[model samples]
Target: MSGTKPPSALSSVKITFLGTASAQPSSTRNHSSLALHLGGDVWLFDCGEATQHRLQKSSVKMGKIQKIFITHTHGDHIFGLLPLLASRLNGSGGTAEGVEDPRLHVSTGENTQPLEIYGPLGTRAYVRNGLMYTHTLLGAPYVVHELRFPTDPLGDFTTLPRNAAELPTGRNIDQIDGHWPDVFADNLVTVSAAPILHSVPCVGYVVNERPVPGKMDPKEYIPAIKRTKTPMSVMSRLQQGEDVELADGTILRGPPRRHGRKIVILGDTYDPSPIAPIAMDADILIHEATNAHLPGIDPTTKEEDTYETVEMKARSHGHSTPQMAGAFAKRIGTKRLFLNHFSARYAGDDDVNAETAEVMNAIGSLAAGEYGGEVTCSRDLMSIDIQLPK
Candidate 1:
C-alpha cells in the first residue's frame, strides 16, 4: 500500500490554532479550537464559539471541512458547532457584494458530501435537539457518531422527530488496552483516539499518515532504463513496488518506503498518559496548559500563588500547567510541544505589553524545563507546518 503512490503525492500536514483560550475567552483569544489541514481536506478538532468566524479569517475553507472531532461537550469547546454546520448547509452565494447571510440563502446550488462528526455520548442528542429546536432544515445531510463508554447510560439512538437529515447509525467507541478504536482512516491518514483524564469523559487523538514510496533516484535508474530501451510506463510500475521487465528483459526494483509524519492533538486534561503508547515518537503534540506559576516573573508571590499551589489548583479543576503539558510531551517522546488552552489572565504572544510578553516567556520556560523539545506557546491564528522527514 505504501508504494501505491509516488512520493510527490504525500500531502503536507498543517495545524492552525483557531482559538487558544481556556474556559473564558480574552480579548486576544477566542476559545478552544484547532484546524488541521491535510491535503485539500480540513479536519476541525474542536469547534468553540466563533469557530466559523475564525475559519473566515484562516486559510481553511468551510466547504473543505470533511470531519469534526469533539474532545468533550464543554460549551467553550463546542458552542460554535451548530452554527458552523448550518453555514455548511448554506451555499456560498449571496448578494452582489458576496456577503453571505444565512437567513437570505438556504441552498443556492451547493453540492456537498455528508459531513461526519465524532464526539462523546451526548453529542448526538445535543446536535439533534439543537437543530430541531432551532427549526434548521439543512441543505445537506449529516451524521454524528457518539463514542460511548461503559459507564455511560444507555439511551435510544434515534434521529430527530421531524427531521430526517441525520443518519441513523454511528460508530461505537470500545476500549482495549487504554485506547479506543481507530476513529477514522483513509488512504491518506489513520486517526486513533484514547480516553484522557479530564473533568469529563474527554479523549485525545493521534493522526498517523500512511507511508509513501521513497524517492526514486533518476540518475541511477534513467541511465539503465535508456540502455534497455524501457518504456516510461515501466518506471511508474517500478515506483509502485512492482518488478518490471524491460525491453531487454532486465528486471528493475523499486525504492524503499519512507515513514509518514505523526501528529497528536489532545483536549483539556490534567494527565494524558493513557495515550502515551499510541502517541509515542510523535512529530508534534498539541497539549493544553490552562494554568502555570513562575516564581520570579509573576508579581503575586503570595503563598497561594506558589508553584505547588498553582499546580494543585489546576489539577483540581481538571487542567494542566505548562510543566504538566511538557511532561506529557516528554513521556510520549514528541519532537515538538505546543502548549495551548491558556487562562484568560495571560496575554497572548501577539500582545505588545512587556509584562504579558514576560508571562508568555515564563510559561514557555516552565515547559522547557521539563521537555527538551521545541516548545511553542500557541496563540490565536498561529499556523505550524509539519513536513515529512527527508
Candidate 2:
C-alpha cells in the first residue's frame, strides 16, 4: 500500500444528456440537463425542466450531484433546477449499494461520488429559492457559485468585490475561481470566454486541459489493499488528492496524477467567437443547433426573414441555427462537432427524422465544407467518451 502511483488522464468524464429540448418540455425532449461524469461526482450543465426525472432514467448518480453549471438563466434551463436539487437532496443523500457504469445505467456494486453545481447569473437566487422550500440534507448543502461575465455592459465572471450587492456567494464551499480567465488556467487547462448575442447577458465557456502521457510507478496497490485491508474508500481518497493515515497517523502523500484536458459542451449562443480556446483544435465541440434553415420560402424574397435561422432572426434573444453553430465550430477549428439544444420543432417526430437527417447532413456538410471538421447530433442520455486525436 506504500509508494503507489495513480493513472494519468483525469477521471473519465461523460456528458449525459437528461434532456436536450429547447423551451418546451415534451415526452421526447425535456429541457436541457447534461451530466458531466467525473468519475465520482457529477457536474450538471443546464438543468432544464424535469432534469431530475431524466436523471432517474439515466445512470447518473443524482445524489452525487450538488454542483451545476448553467449556461444562461432561461426559464427552460432553470425551472428544473428546483425539482432536481430538491429530489436529490430529499430522496437520496448518497448512492445505493448497487450501481455500475454501463456508463449508462446506474449499477449497484461499484463506488460513486456526490455532485456539485456551477453556473452564470441568477444561480444564487435560483438555488436559494429552491433550497428555501425543500428539506435537503446537504452537509455541504449543495453549493452554488454564480459566474458573471465581466468588463462589457454584461455581467462579470471575474473581478468583483466580495461585498458587492449583486455578487453571489459560494455555498459551504470555500474557494472558487469563477473568473472566466482563470476557469481553465488554474486547472492547467487553457480556457476562454466572451459575450454572445443572447437576450440578457449570455457567455460561453471553452476548456482545454493538458494531456497525461505515460504511466507512473504506483502499480503495486492491488496487493497492498489485500494485505492491509485499507477500505477502497480510504484508498480512493489517497489516489484522488488526499493523504492516507493510519490510526497511529502514518501519512501516505498522494502525488499529482496525470490527466488530459478536454473541451466541454460549447452550449447555446446567438454568437460563438468568444470560446475559441475551448474549441482550439478541440477534439470535440458540442454547440447548439436550434435552427436548420429549411428552404421552401426564399430568404431574400421573404422580407421578414431576410436573415433566417434562430441566430440571425432572434439575434439578441439567445439562440443559434445549425448554419451559424456549424460556422462557429468550423471557425474555431474544432476537430469534432456535436449539435444539441434543438428546437421543439424536431423532437421525436418520425416525419422529422428525414428532416433531422437532412439538417444534420446539411450542417455537417456546412461545417466540413467550410471548417473541415466532423459533425454529429447529440441524443438524449447518449454517452460520448472523447478520445484525444492521434
Candidate 3:
C-alpha cells in the first residue's frame, strides 16, 4: 500500500481553487476558476469573471501563469479572459509603427514566451473579437487553440481578421470516443481533454505527471564506490538506470522508477462519465456539485424535495448534485474527491453562520456516501497539495 508523501518530494503539484460558484457570484465566492501550480509554471483551469482579482487574493503569482484552459465559452466560465490577458501587458516605452495610439504602446518586451490558451469551439472568435472591440493592447503575445467536435458549427477561419500577436488555430476532436487530440505536453506533465455531457460543448481535463526517478541513497553507494576505488562518475550512470561496472568488477543497478500522480478537473456538467477511461485511478478528482439534497440540515429543502427530485432538477439545468460527483469519482477510482462550483443559494465557507457549516458538511457527506474515499467541499482560495505514494 502507498502512503501520502509531502510536497517537498519529487515533482510537487498543488491545486488552488480561485472561484467555486456555479453561474452567479456571491459576496464570498467568485466564478469558476482554479490554478494548478506545477513547479515554476501555473496552469489555469478556467477564468471566470473577477478571476484575476481572485488570483491577487490567493498565493498564486499572476506572472507565473503560462497556460489557460477553458472548459466552455459560458460567461461564468470565460468572462475574465480578456482582462487577464490585458493585465499581462505592462507599459514599455513604445508605440505601434503605423498607428500612434497611446493605448497600443504596451510592449511585450518583458514577456519571455507567448501564452497558450486552449478551449472548445468558438474560443478563437471570442478572444479575437473581445480584444478587437475593446482595443486592448497585450504586452505579450497570445495563441488561442480551439478543439472542435463534429457537431459544432463551422466558421470561415480565413475570413476572420488576423492580428500578428494573436495566433489562432483549430483542430477536430477525436470522433471515436470524443477525445481531444494534442491537448498539451511538457517535460513535467501531459494534459488531455474529453467531451462531457452539458448544454454547451464542455470538456473535462486529465493531467498526468511524468514519471519521476526513484530515490537513490548516497550512503549506500558512496561508501561502496570509495572502497572499490571507482570514479564518482559511475554513480551518475547508475542513477540513469545503467549497469555501471566498477573497478571491483561489480555491477550496480538503479532503483525502479515511481509512477506519477494523476488529477481530473471537470467543468459544469450533468454527466462526466465520458472521461472515465483517461481519468482512471486519479489521485484527486475535482467535480462540480451545483445542487445537493441535504434533507433535514438543508434550509432550502422542503418536504417534497427528495434525492430523486433534486437530482432531476440539477440535471435538467445541466448541472450535477453531490451524489453525481461521488458516483463519477467512484467510477474513475479516484482516491480523493473535492466538490466545487456550488450554487449561489448555499452560503460559502467564508460565511460565519451555522447554516454555512452544516450545508458544507452535508455536501461532503452526500459524496462520501457513494465514494468510500475522502471527500471535501471546496471553497474559494482553498489550496490542496497533491500527495504521492511512498
- Which prediction has the highest lDDT against the true structure? 1
For candidate 3, write residues 183-298 as lDDT tens digits. Answer: 88766678898888898889899998866656788677887789899889877655644566677787777665576888999998999978888899999999999999887787
Q: Flag regions of model 3 displaced more than 4 Å.
A: 1-11, 91-112, 153-158, 168-177, 233-237, 350-353
- Give each model's clash number: 0, 30, 1
Question: Which lDDT tens digits does candidate 1 get at residues 1-390?
Answer: 354454334466899999999999888898899999988889999999999988898888899998999999999999999899889865232345766445442332335356889988878878878787776667667778777776776663555552355654556666676677577877768898988899998989899887776778767678778898776767776665566667777777887767788999999899998888899999999999998887777675465577888999999999999999888888889999999999988778545778878888889889989997789899889998898867
lDDT of 2 at 150: 48
Q: After superposition, which runs of candidate 2 have C-alpha atoms over 4 Å from their true positions?
A: 1-7, 91-115, 133-140, 151-179, 184-194, 215-259, 296-311, 348-356
Candidate 2 displacement at residue 259 in angstroms: 8.1
Write down the lDDT that model 1 would get: 0.82
In candidate 3, the residue pairs with backbone N, CA or C atoms under 3 Å apart (3 or more residues apart, or in different chains) clash, namely: 108-139
Query: Which clashing pairs does model 1 show?
Result: none
* Sort order, TM-score high to low: 1, 3, 2
Q: Candidate 3: lDDT over CA atoms?
A: 0.81
Models ranked on lDDT: 1, 3, 2
